[model samples]
Target: MPPASLPPLPLSTAAGYQARHLLVLPGDVLVDEVETLAVSRFAGARWDVVPAGVEPATVAPRTAAPGEPGVLRTSRHTTLTGPFAPGPGLPPGSAMVFDVVTPRERGEAAFPGSGDRDGLGRAFPAGLPEKEERRAVDWLVEAARRLGGSIAVDVPSSGAPGIVLTPDPGVAVDMTLYSDVWLEPDAAQAVLGQVDGRIRLAMDGVDWQGPPAGIADKPLYRGEQMDPAVRKQIHAAADDVDIAALTSGEPLDGYGLLLDLGVDGMIAVEIGDEPDLPFLLRGLPWAAGGAVSYRVRWEPDDLAASQDEFPPMEYTVARKRSAGIVAALAKALHGAVGGEIADEAGFLVEPDDL
Candidate 1:
């Protein structure tokens, strides 16, 4: 290494204070948890016990530079290494990090280790899946097996289903299946009243695209699925369509099965004209209320596509545990892709997000 003075851990690493040394423990299998709440908050939404000076709020996620080990991003500033590749001093197969810092204090320090540091102490490394995460994995596998097999029906994972929503209103969901399957504009509108009060599935906006011809026809609003060429002609004519009046029509039935069954996460899909395609599934957002959402992209990277490509299907899940939901999604996607989908960074950080 470079210096002997570095502590085993650090909070604001740039400041280099071991203020409760915050090392990414270089291992897995640490232990920790508690309290009860709604299934919505069942396992994800919780607080971390950090030192007074070590504000979790300010901390930012730090990962080894590209070509280095993968990052385990639990939250914004809280990402650390995953169990598979522990750092120095950490034993192989160590599920949790053993230790890091040596000193910390509540109030101001005479020596003065102060300031926001813009983030919290470096995140601690992860160990094994918590009880909940493990359960999520199991539940997803079972659900996938059932759905993939001849049982020939959708299975809702029982518990408070963690739902994911999109910012755009144009997306419609096929309730019969668990994942995000896109619907025609009419179909998307039909489910609104039914899912009233249900948590919206929040996404980071990269995974969406304009719906296909039939699905996107009769634009929901101006520019919604409107072709650029056609828009120019309309603009030349100075015409305005009453989008609201145009869209007001009778709602379709049976698309509410996803909400009706109450699943953890739903993936709505829109098929492209191309028969089979390769794509990327990026960003996993485990929301504040405890919903896990991710993006699925069909385009491959120019210089760095993976030999093992991403799977080509969209899906949803409602289940006993988000751990199961997250894990199952990962497993299914991972298995579907057959290996790995290379990211710009080359490290598969998104996969470990589960």
Candidate 2:
């Protein structure tokens, strides 16, 4: 059992202040996977939708159902999960949430915390004692290696040790080792020459909690007004899913931060959902919902004979963009038939279009 000092949700609500660091996972993975990973080795690790009234935590291991509104009561943290839209029961505040991701979650360490300097509404919290720093990094690196997908991490301010693993395999310049700790010449070469080139060195307390950079250059515009930062983040996340679905053919995973800025209502997209990436650009009928939507459906009509090199096959394609305030302008301008042609259908919106 954790010490009595760690307050539960109800009590914390009354106090009116909640602090926590959100460890957002890769969208492709299931929430259950995150829960399972927490119990496998990192016991204090947990996820929540965050509460309102101004916000979200850990305990016995349990999982919340998709879109369910409730609290997970365990030995460690009392986590409240939900859509949190300030509905009938879900008021408007913010979820006071955190995960037991470090040694401190188990009562093993501590560190100094600080706010973001980039003018973004995020924080770079401190934790992980000297004895456990390397071990934590190693564990995180190993997890990244196993996941084999795009991932990133944030470290505390004060130049403490922290790293985020990305998929690009490019050695970024200005990588930080620790407080005033830059990679040595030999170490830098060795690091770059080594195996997977996905590791990213982070410093000054920043979280790699969004999509991989340049996942897609397309822009998505929403009519609903929101903070520019939040708008940009969600657009990037949508591009991530858009590329994944079109190329890799993966279903929409979902989008949102483990913790939100609490500055505006969330505008998110989820897999197995409507107003999704597919119907929007695929020229398929989109189910009406408050959210911007999309869909697509196609079948191989007939194979065309190619005289020279290309694949000896051809089929028709159709595409379109959403008409919402934050809709995508069909970039695949096939006669502007909503970005569709006789055999090909699609479009691309630049990042700046938003």
Candidate 3:
């Protein structure tokens, strides 16, 4: 049979243009295999495929899936199968797959009822849990090794707490903050309050209605409506406070502090509307040399339109920015940490040398 064409959907659209890697959720291999072959044959693009399964630690040892032929190997990719369980509450069946592609590849349409309904207003289709997603991510990382491609995982900032997998010394792993979860004023304040005594606060681009003391010297780095004066105030506040640490919502301009800024800890905030923020946060501390943690909060919304719009406009904007930051951070940090591994990958060698 001939390979299938890219699906008609947002993921497919993004994958077709922007994706450097393709991740296929478990139980969806049929779709992925068909699409991958089609893309390779028709589009003249080669995609690396990785199978998904539960880790041995999590699931009891079991045979590979039926007709899969245990651990198929090829020059382009490797495929493995096992009794891998999906995260909690995932439908009875779930698996993971990886398809490494370039920006030129297109994506297929969302599975029927598998995505949020258009105009539904913040309504999302039911999905699997975190562990399930993590399994997919882990598979991608492993796949990177066989395919000689860099691996990056998108996670949330608040949920940034997990055991780090030390990849091959030279191999670079990217940890990005997923920014779909909104931090409401109260929630943000509470997080700030938690670190009030432990660390001083400051702001870079945001404004305060009153004295800096009102914000407890906590820096609101790179936020909405932030200005130069606000940044100055944050700097001044940093000097006054003990300056236990520094964090930014995103990498700053003229902010060489990240490399030389001496502090007990440093955190890069990943804000987004996606639920993946926590995963990213958990994975970052390992990528960067530091002891780090994340806090998540969201604003309450009361919209009487469709069930889809409840997340509020402010939350949506924040989420978009958050996702962008996470994507940027993943690329940057991956280069910083995994440049050597990427070099060994060979495909990225020219880019690195340049």
Candidate 4:
């Protein structure tokens, strides 16, 4: 959907602070259907019905008041023409739109307390609390079961980038903060073994290879196996603790690795960290002090032209395979190293949630 048609959700109206999510359906859905879904999904919760295009602020503060029952205004749009047309990567067709508005102070059920913190007590500044975002995403996913479409986080005014949630199952995976702590080579290898075993068992046709072709010959960016500059910076920033001696040998046997899951995807596991001190981990409250900071990325294999034309089912299969491997790798690392993980979309990913 175009930004122009996507009205920015008001941060604060007379109704107090609020948040909204957009659900785009493949076909027109009746307002009654939307109402039923809302009622069923949020049973016993108060709901205030409003006409289409009604600003949330104009509504009374009954739902917005502290400790009062939360209010949700569901607005339906049947005519998805012009700027409201469905964009690429979304289901193509005439679309139906629904805007679901909720109060911002929904507490831990919707968001985390203060700055985003994990079970390990790591806290970091996040624009939209990852916990709340995950809760909203759960609703969108539920909506998709009945509505058959896509969802987007409508935050055009916040200066943050727009986030779209879809089941496109695209051929890419970028998991950040996969591990908050680094393990010794032996422990790292054990984690790798667990991840490798899990991936192989979960995905039927996965093939593992040592590094990508020519990576060994290339000038290493983050380390020489280790970088003197990075070592000095780490030592200085980390109260003179020798993180290098702590990490010792390469993680997962080698810094470079690959997973080929047939023609659908080719995922590269790049293991390393920032050359210099990362701003997020520089000072106090630096939770990921021992982080190895690896990244898992994927792309279509050499037969890109052929794979690009594959059907939706193929794409979804590829996505599932790649996503599963990334999840397994992350879960294993978290279990071994003790830290949090984030998904491609930058939301905190709990290992148990996998």
Candidate 5:
């Protein structure tokens, strides 16, 4: 079946604050199937429609009939949106909300812990216990496959922005890598060489350089002075102490490198093994167990034009380039040290997976 399309829904400030996921079904599905799906997953669970003005928390959930729309309360905090009309198109579809919040507060009081002050804390948040989030992701992936569709995340700020579960590989640039053994600076440099080679094979005559000489003299708009200085610092420190600080987290020590991809952007590579893997990359058993890993990221140049919201052509192109680059790097790393590559959505990346 062709891929289902999800029109960007208006972002609800209240519900949208937490990372939100939606399941987009490509074709029409009978309400019976939806019920069956819920039962299969939740085991004899019942769904009910909270009357027009009544709150979900206030009412007891009576069994919903086959064609009736309702809410499937999986737990006290999580609820999956019930069935809605599947619209028309060659790849016609409708989205079911997978919310990780209480129905009564509608996610207002969900996962409130945060030690991050002044934007310095772990990149991996303490929000929603990993166990709970994992349960949610597992169900979402299962639901998408059950419906012959894909999983999508509407939150752009998510670590895995523009993530969709599709067979035909598409670029999702933001990626993380977990390795069983520590890969040192020398090994990392070798991996960088491999990545550079792959990119050159794909794009002819692309420039490869570090922060240029006299970068300070160059205008910011020229994009000549582009350098991931912070990443470079992390890399130097990693060489000394071999631990890297996570986003918003304290800098201990770690190994990393930054390669300027010119127009595509700068790639930041950081290595650390102390912390558990980011939630987005823990789908696999071994990865979930945790190991030394590299967080490969693409930082777009500031001058790049903002992608148009409607068409998203520019954005698509940028992601393709960046994602392709990181994919190349992942393949190279896999070849070098024998590790797994995972995208932002935490799925193990196959060669065909972008």
Candidate 6:
């Protein structure tokens, strides 16, 4: 039978819809270009680019008492995070955070009780462009609406800028910017447009590769008793192909070492209990190629034991969730960077299950 046609998920009904909108605010021109290229491949649903120092606002001191010299009074300062509370529309998750600092600010003293020790606070001499910042915010708000989501911005006391999105229940999108100066409106919009185009491509299935072919060579390996002529013939037949060689007691191991070999996919054949296949597959770089599969051989007794150890139900759910996340992230990143394929690190979590 022919393969089933993939169904389309409207932005509103997408499984991980919240993670689909990506915001990138790189302070450096070179780094921003690289990140933009990386994100474009996945086709981020909504992409925004702004100055690096922008962030979502947290609590800040409102005002000081009138006529009070050197005595500061605290008052509540209104910020966007107040209205955007964490809820079903905004799920909690962790991400690996990175920041860039200039040489002048590298040795700046931290506040007495700074919560984040790694945070540097030297005031770099760069003008902030308010108009451009507002434009970025406007782009985000419009994008969110198109995706049936909401936007949240953070402006912290440390003078950094942040952008966050609450696209749906149980998901929150956050990004920070730290650059020498604010980005111009033209440049920021150009980046956003690039991302928008890529996201469309990703949604249309531009980056997927079909399943790979099975192992191309047989006899696994020739024995010493085999004639040299026969062995040479077998090796010749296996040329430019992937073949697995195994030993009875040796831990199964083989390397694909052919020069200029173009592999469309990969499969790891193992002689072990099925339960061990998952762990073995984890060691392979599954993201590098088009497709990946696994084949395992086991003794009859081992197979029975492994059957009990493997949780087929849970595996199926996990697999589906992972696939959904991959697709969503790929589309989102492609949208953000203008249609460039993203690296493995970009898909940080399984959006559906999260």
The top-ranked prediction according to lDDT is: 5
- TM-score of each candidate structure, all chains considered together: 0.22, 0.21, 0.21, 0.38, 0.45, 0.15
- Worst 10 contiguous positions by lDDT, candidate 6: 71-80
Residues 107-134, model 4: lDDT tens digits: 2331333221111112112333344444
Best by TM-score: 5
RMSD of each: 21.3, 27.4, 20.6, 16.5, 15.6, 25.3
Provide the lowest-lDDT 10-residue window in model 3: 253-262
Evaluation by TM-score, superior candidate among 3 and 5: 5
CA lDDT of each prediction against the hidden true structure: 0.25, 0.27, 0.30, 0.46, 0.50, 0.25
Model 1 alpha-carbon drift over 4 Å, by segment = 1-21, 26-323, 333-354
- Candidate 1 overall Cα lDDT vs. reference? 0.25
lDDT of 3 by residue, 1-354 (tens): 111222111222122222222332434345334333322222222223222331221122343443231222222222222112222222233343333322222224334533221211111123221232323333454433323333322211223212222123222222322222234433433443443322223234553334446463344654555565776777667655533333334442111111111221232332223322222232354434322112221211322211231335654454444333333433433333242112211112122322
Candidate 3 has an lDDT of 0.30
Which 10-residue window of candidate 5 scores lowest in summed lDDT?
A: 115-124
lDDT of 6 by residue, 19-71 (tens): 12222221222222323322322222111322232221222233222221111
Q: Please give the distance, in angstroms, between residue 139's alpha carbon in candidate 6 and its true position after superposition.
A: 5.5
Residue-pair clashes per prediction, in order, are: 47, 36, 54, 2, 9, 50
- Ten-residue segment with the worst summed lDDT in candidate 4? 116-125
Which regions of candidate 4 are displaced past 4 Å?
A: 1-149, 152-172, 178-180, 184-187, 197-254, 262-264, 274-284, 288-291, 302-312
